[model samples]
Target: MDVDFTFRKPIDVSVILSTLLDAGMRSSTEGREVAYLVDEDGMFEWRTAAEYQLNEVMRELGDPRWNDRVVGMTLFFAEAETGGDFLFHPGRESMSCVVGINPKLFQGSSRFCDIGWYLANLVPLLEPLGLSEIEARDSP
Candidate 1:
């Protein structure tokens, strides 16, 4: 399906990223995982991960249900070396989206691919749900 990522405002991508990380970490299934992304030039860069800052922000966000939810259905780490459009799929619960927080990886496989998948798909959904965009200071 053709997924829509329209947003009301320009959200600080980093903040949303950190929130996902915090939620993932708090769940305890994964201690810490960094989201990876592929740039225009096909370069890999590290995005955000579960860290002290994300935890603090999560605490401030103060939504137990939000943390509990996976935001989307199935999140995975994928690398399209050939370069193609992002793939969007359905999840068991509501929906699924992937975010490439980190840069693209040209060589070998990306270890942070899991987080990358989440960021690429979920970030756009944040605004519609009444979530505020990250501020300048919050963005990395």
Candidate 2:
């Protein structure tokens, strides 16, 4: 099974990334994407976050949870490697979007992936700037 979340607006990818790092969540520090089609050769090799800050990672190993929920499904592939058509599934426009946040956002993934943490943290963290209210979903 696969899971993902969606936002009402375009979020600051940087903030999310920095937040993940700060919260100590772990994903892939590298992905397979082209930051700018013209800047580099059209190659989809494993590239570090620095290679494409355009979207997503850092480096660590931890499953953050909130209120007995898992923040992420824990995939070995990089976010960019997810697919070119982000949030878009085959023959569909909505894909399982993976927005990796730090485990701290969920108050540590030791067990639960709680929404409360998002309310307490993500809200104040983004609401002020109007970047909150992302909904999570589970898909097969």
Candidate 3:
């Protein structure tokens, strides 16, 4: 499934990165689940809030189509072995959680459900961090 969420107010890239990192850290401590930063070379590396440079990452991994606009910033955060990924594009005011391949190629996978559950709980956490007017969309 293709899950998309939009925040109420425009958020800074640095703030978004920090919030996600904080969430990752909390999840890690709780032993629930943690997200990793997937780079352009498909490397899944764990990064802390201080390690992320939004501009640098965007330039290295972001889609060229969005290069001209701030909206091109794309950060892929995936849960280990879940086949789930949260694609954060702060510039677009949206984040997408996807599992397996696109709907056109596959019906959907268990990973989708796993990520769905993760995102469901995450939304609440994000609200306290400054996200509001949250809206979710899933592909049929």
lDDT digits (tens) for residues 48-81 of candidate 2: 3343443433211111211121111222222222
Superposition-based RMSD of candidate 3 using all C-alpha atoms, in angstroms: 8.6
In order, candidate lDDTs are: 0.33, 0.32, 0.45
Q: For candidate 3, write residues 1-140 as lDDT tens digits.
A: 55566776544444555565455522232233333453433443544332334445433334444422333122333343333455656364666555543222223653224445656646765666556554444454
* TM-scores of the models, in the order given: 0.29, 0.30, 0.44
lDDT of 1 by residue, 22-138 (tens): 444222224454233322233333344454444443343333334322232112232332111222112211222333334343246544233344345455445554443332111
Off by over 4 Å in 3: 25-80, 83-85, 88-91, 101-112, 133-140
Global CA lDDT computed for model 2? 0.32
Give, for candidate 3, the lowest lDDT window spanning 10 residues.
67-76
Q: lDDT (0-100) at residue 6 of candidate 1? A: 34
Each candidate: how many clashes? 28, 13, 0
Higher-lDDT candidate among 1 and 2?
1
Q: For each candidate in turn, give its C-alpha RMSD to the true structure in angstroms.
A: 13.8, 12.7, 8.6
Q: Candidate 1: where are CA atoms >4 Å away?
A: 1-3, 24-35, 38-40, 43-96, 99-140
